[model samples]
Target: MATTTFSKLVVFAALVFVGQAALITKPEGPTIRTRHGDVRGMYAEEGAIFLGLPFGNPPVGELRWKPPRAYNKSWAPEVRDGTVPGPACRQPGCGPNKIDYRHTCNRDKNRTQSEDCLYLNVFVPRSVLLNSSLRLPVICWFHGGHYMYGTGSAMVYDGRILANKTNTVVVTTNYRLGVFGYLVTGEGEDDARGNYGTLDQIETLKWVQQNIADFGGAKDKVTVFGQSAGSDSISVLLTTDKTTDLFHQAIMLSVPFSITHKTQLEAIRVGNDVAKSVNCSAGDMKCLRSKPADDLIVAQNEAGKYIANPFKPLELFMQWGPTVDGDILPRQTVDSFANGKIQKKPFIIGNVREEAVLYIYEAFSKPMSKLELDGIMLAFLHGKGPVALHEYNPPKASDYRPFLSHFATDWVFQCPTRNVIRNAVVNGENDVWLYVFDHVVSIKSIWHHKAYCQDHVCHGEDIPFVFQTPLLLNLSFTREEQVIADTMAYHYGNFAHTGDPNKASPNVYTTGNVLKSPLDWPRYNKRNLFPNMNFTTPQSVIVKDYNKEKCDFWDKENIYSARNKGK
Candidate 1:
């Protein structure tokens, strides 16, 4: 009897071990029904399964430059496995250092280029889909590389951590870039072609609406978030009617609605010039489309060299960006918001503390004078020179020029972000929360040594922290820094779950000034005074009296420029 009991006990132990292993192993792939046909995706990580599914037909041959069509054919005999990501859309070379110019001139190479690029990757936590009973929130992230470079496959944007931590489903997608995505093809049916990339994003969201439930996500609760140019795309999407009902909330990081096509006409002209250099007629769309891909890439490189700001050209004649085509974008985003046509949804918008400082620091090796500072202020503030000067005064000591660059930060990044908040508030959409990320990291070398004095929170510094991907920082974070990352992730996750970021489970560090919300970060209106939220060491809110005089001056100058067509 004792031997029999011992044998039974051993069997029970073996069964328990097997059950534990099963719990830890990745979940199985589930088939989801899409508009086109059914496709299956496999388990990606511990608590998530990612299906890199394609939604639209190949945009090639006669379909080139036209709106993407719905993919209708079913997969063949082999079971569909959305494990590997799709190729990026045909455009310029996204090399780590040099921008390849051969991408612009070659139609043959472009055709050979993978036409099956209209795909998106979805990440849904296994816990949320299989065990957890709750419907998870969905977040669709649009990658930013100036609308020129970047792909959805970048390691920094992996959604596994975000999904596991927030219990949310995350989706990131790839779309056409550069000329293929933004070229205006004249006033016929093609004039409607400027924003194919944006259209791709819209289609991806629609796909999620139809299929995300299989991954255990709430179709109605979707938020679109992007940084830099991606943020610009989010702003455009917010103002567009095509994306309405597709997403319920938006988070715009660093980019603003004021960034319009006027700032990018110069790049388009430069692209046109490059086409001409490659023996392609600027006026003949067919000729341009027929060129080899490598030649087009070379043309783009040549064009980049000719433009003054290769990174972000100041010339209007050589810019490349979303154009106000009557279809995708019926009107300018600024006009759309002012006219109240923009979708009325909750928004979370803010900028890093010292945005543009690193870019300027890298560009100019010299210190800026008071006059130069004021000039920049006037340019950005639209002539509100004195008001900005008063609020953001340079230190009396000449050595403080670096610190004084904060004026540039507030003018270019902070004020514009606030303007987005102001617009949302003016529309009576009070669901806007503003933040200023002042938590500076210790690694100054990554920022080219500018971190010594200015405490530069350069553009995009908040992304890794918010995503809890500190390892992407390329440097180790201190214990405190890790705490900051956790707090940031918690706050972001909270915002995703509920519209309010303050609703998250509070952490001890988060309760302190480090992660606390700014003081009185009130909604903007014509009547209410403009308030500034400071995300400093100890976060607090302060009602800032914007240098009214400088603001008025800039406003008047902008009005005059608009009347005179200086834009």
Candidate 2:
């Protein structure tokens, strides 16, 4: 009887052990199942990070100069490693002496460059991912390098800090640059149309729309934001009918609006120059496509050096970009916005205080004389030179770089931005806000080798503050600088969340990163005094009619009048 009782006790103990084992679940890593494959990411203090996820097929071989195709290869049974960043797209390497204030060229030194560079990175806060019901707003970023250089994987652009602070998902993507992306020969079976890079951007947006739900993101709440060349790309994308449903809001930072896109004839000329450099016929697309990417980069650089825009001489500086393709890009950005051809959405557009100082310092090694300034004005405006010179006359005639910088600022960035904003408002688009980043960068070495921008609020200066990268780099910001950085992030975060810069996110308190600014950002309108937020240290304030007279003059003269003549 005792042996039988012991046997029964052993059977009961075994059953209890089995039941307890079934109740305890095993801990899993930060693994996400995407449509392309199952990817294993790493967990940082703030969130789960997925790096180097390919959204499109490799654009190599016969796929060169073609629109991007969706990534279809699946790694279903096995998990793909996404811990390392992908290679940057093929571009010309810049030396240490070049104007790499953003340190993009140097960042490429650490990563490889290849034609298969259609990859993107994602950052999701830990709390959002763990909670099944939390779906955060998404901010898709595009980096700036004049459409010539830059990768989405640069260290300075890491989206972890921004994701953590804003409690949103942040995605940064890579697009082709220079000849590989924008060269147009008017040949080939596909016609070799330009704007392949912009197509890549659209492909990325499609990927986000399809896959972001798995990463705790709201597909309908996506906001596209960029700086400089990236911002210009957004302006072009705004006009395209293809991106109508991809994004709900936009924030263009320091768009170079005066640098008009190339016409079809001009693009063909540039393409011919490239082909000629490589010992091929102007119309022979097969030969151009078969050549090595490195060889093509050299040819594109050579072509850019000689192809000057007669209508706007300054446009030669940015010769290779979006072409006015009749279908995808209906017309120029300014014209499209003015005619209400763009998708109706809320947006924030702004420029820095000294947007042109960086370019001026790079162009001229020494200060300019009054004679040289007059010559520059004539070169810029042609028949209208004298009038422009009189209108933009400097108070201190001897030291004219400051005024020259201001004139270039108004012409290239500030004035044209205002014109677009006003046009958008008048055309029944009521939700638009304007701002000017008026604070100078406090960190001297962050300027890379170009120390000239240390004292001025130059182009690309607002980026670090927006990303709050100083904290990521173990560098410290001054008390005032920290406040400004927080304030910019706060406004941008709010804009991403609710499509209103002044409305704080309801979930902001959950992240314990609540941000506050004393000033209330006002929507831009003709009746509201055209208030523009001046972002600076200590506090940000609103100013009315910023550069009104200069903007009005440029709008009247219409530097891009050639676009209308052709239309």
Candidate 3:
């Protein structure tokens, strides 16, 4: 059900869309002549907002499971309406009985869902829009939902505050999700070889390159940034030359690097499970496409139960994702980074402190027993479990949930992130910086249902601060929280303007209230004990080799799927 305020917002959007039907030579609000048409957007206190702009044609019917086609049709004579966001791409609800606030089902309630969802939203600051001659750096955001659920235009990712504070044109886009986006059959030409979502991202970058200049954004100064699955997509973008000309720099938040991308056969195994659930034969593209979207969603849920990634059991939680299709993604992400096959673009990559707490709680209803912990270690770490359990050193008799949570955090997010950084730097990829988001958000309502995340700096905790959307949610930020948000936006804004996060470009504007980092971040290197920026309260400072011993153990174990498995 939609809230009264949201219902009113929708009514207002409809009137605005209908009212601006005809083309006016000089409209009142901020107008931009895009390649598709002349789009008229609304003006707010912060800046101009252009929502629901199509970057690619609707991926429906024959287009399902195919690469996105650029939205080439023109709405010139009839002005294209950019008032409200386009419908979120088709996706499933949250975990079975669990109330995960992050899922698209909960976040995008009462909002339309459709296959015609390849739309992107643009947010430009009032100052930047007022000066027709000024072209600021652009930041393109990719929302994350484990590549299964999430939309770019959700209130949580409202780019207005970030755009105003960063002084950059912010773009949030929607791509296909679930089986519709990443179901793979086989290596045949007719097969839906996965990574359609990745292709959609590529098409988005191409569109930005062609049309961002009209919205006061420099195409050459584009920076791609995202969290979780979005970050995973950006990491893939960094490896392939397909995105070489699309973006200049990248910012990856909470990338699940340890959940190794599925091999072609592995993807096909899951695809077949989804197909069988719907009574369709494997590799039957026509049959799969003919089925209703609802059927596919249900099938996707059922498929997770039938298959598992033996090398990485955690993958069963996030089953539908990009596949190593040999074409789009030639090799695994870490392998590419380790072998120097990746583009040497400037990037900042990091993760939250207690990334796996929520996930751990969700996986276990109550505190885990020592036996369960031993089983987890054996299942996740293989022969390396005994050595790892010795290193982690959990209490034998008491509940081991905390130990499991910390271990999962280190094994899944923190250690893998450090591994990627180490690989990138060792392979001569410079201009890289690292950080750890250690502050827990003050707003408890965001995770009200998930009580375990109340005090932990869990996954997705940094999003509200990064976009500064607490005010939009009818909530307020504490003084310390506000400072942290300001500091993050400050560094991110500087990074978008200049390759270095500490330095701001002359072209970009900075306000008197903009917060600065307590210390200058140093380039990540093998020497100097690998310093990383610890983004925390009153002041964010540089820390040396966070969880160094734990990461060393994981690295030495050589258990990560892609490690020591040569390309």
Which candidate number would show the highest TM-score if scored against the true structure? 3
lDDT of 1 by residue, 1-567 (tens): 111133332333344335653554333444554444445665443244454577788887666667778666777544567665666666565433432221211112222235457877777654553343456889888877667766665555767667766667888777777666666535554432467788888888888788777666789999898887788888889877788889999887887333455323443465567668789765466777677656766665566555423332332222455776666676666556656777888877777777767656655567766677666545544444565466545676554346545554544456555555665677778777766677786655444435533465777777766565445435666656665565555556677788766675331123233433333345444455665444544333444644445445434434212121223
Cα lDDT listed for each candidate: 0.60, 0.81, 0.82
* Better candidate number, 2 or 3, judged by TM-score: 3
TM-score of every model? 0.77, 0.91, 0.92
Model 2 lDDT tens row, 143-243:
89888888888877888878876788999999999998898888456667889899999999999999998788999999999998899999988999899
Best by lDDT: 3
lDDT of 3 by residue, 302-355 (tens): 887755567667786678788887778988887787688888989999999999
What is the Cα-based lDDT of residue 226 in candidate 2?
96
Clashing residue pairs, backbone N/CA/C < 3 A, model 2: none
The alpha-carbon deviation from the true structure for residue 534 of candidate 1, after best TM-score superposition, in angstroms, is: 4.0
Which portions of model 2 show Cα errors greater than 4 Å?
1-29, 94-109, 395-399, 509-515, 560-567
Clashes (backbone N, CA, C under 3 Å), per candidate, total: 33, 0, 0
